[model samples]
Target: MRTRVLAASATGALALTALAVPAAQADGGSGDIRITKVVVDGDNKVTIGTGSAKTFSVSVTATDDSGIAGADSFTLAGPGYGFESTGKPSCKKVSATTSTCTASVKTDPRTDYLSNAMAGTWYVGVWIDANDHDYVWKDKAGSFKFQRGSALTTNASPEPVKKGKTLTVTGKLSRANWETLKYGAYSGQSVQLQYLKKGAKSYTTLKTVKSNTSGNLSTTVKATADGYYRYVFAGNSTSGAITSVSDFVDVK
Candidate 1:
């Protein structure tokens, strides 16, 4: 579906600040108006970087006996804060009484001030109205993983080393801090050292190393042939996974 970016700023921010999941979940209205499913970013994993705002799609499927009219708004709440804007739902009829509405929503770095602690599970709050004046409101309709964009970098030393000589690989793991609007170290996480031989189709994991307190990584591997070496981080719940740029080392 076609989607557009919607950022919360100024008045929009002020309005959405009151969004909350009262007692976790609730629904209202007659005629059986109900929210069936909500999909955020396809797999429900939103990864926002320090660059431009990340625009994501939200699909809300609802059913009503009198036919679905549309949705009112969509709010995302997490940790200590929340953000939302009036959803411009594009409704598609699934049946006589069911319609799926989708909208393009976004979390912008320029206006939305988010902290590191806010990266985790976030709940979606919405309201749906039907054609026959029936409506329903849900405080916590669904939830998804909200994560920070992570990055990894690598560099292998000693160019053109002997075939059996040890090559030192060094790198760092960092992620976007939405509040500070900067990339910060992601310390004490396990990262893998992978190698891809020249002319090889894929890379193979050589060994694993954990990032230091400063998110620095250093490891040694015996150079066997001309190949590329890189670092990969399998991220946790609050951060997006990433792979470092491949560094090629030529061996004699």
Candidate 2:
């Protein structure tokens, strides 16, 4: 069973009718059950969009003198407070007394109708039981980013221009708006314009442009050779990073 609770942060008890979860305790363990490490979504970034649900994984590593029996649940609490993983994770034993527990989680905003407040810092809570009747419960086991999805679009005009002529490039930066269930302009953000020769294996940064009040971008560059142009946004605290599709231009 998954438990969803609303809390400003990861602390205190979560009282649900007929199921009173104890106040999250730090390093809760009995006789050698130890939570060694916790990792979220590998790099610790969970990006979700308005179009579809996003899925990620969490791994909890623990050790006990008597070996691990299993875990009760894994709670993901953040700005909006999140999902609780109740089923046992895919368990792999590393040694006589240590095991790594991993589980996958899916997040869909449409189902919950949660607001943008869900994007921010998040924490993980864990409960692992040991083979010898020992158990461990730890809140704030690990932390990760829960960010809103972002997108970038690029367009380069004058498909074929003189070698010395000027070419214009334009694009827009937008991010998912949880409240409206749509993408909205992301203004006042710096996005890098990049270029790649027709057959070049990679792209190089040409210049950086800041999105206007309307989240629109426009820039000009001298045409030198056949190449592709695109815009890349590094993103910020609330939004995920993105790169625009490259637009190709032929130089005469």
Considering every candidate listed, which one attains the maximal TM-score?
2
Q: How would you encode candidate 1's per-residue C-alpha lDDT over 1-252 as one tens digit per residue? A: 001122356666533434433442666556678888999989888888887877898889999889998886676667645445536788999999999988887667657666677788888887788999888878778898888999999999899899999999999999998778889998999999999999999999999999998899999999999999999998777999999999999999
lDDT of 2 at 205: 94
Model 1, residue 53: distance off in Å is 2.1
Model 1 off-target regions past 4 Å?
Answer: 1-25, 29-36, 63-67, 95-98, 130-135
lDDT of 2: 0.81
Candidate 2 local lDDT, 165-187, one digit each (tens):
99999999999997687999999
Show the colliding residue pairs in model 2: none
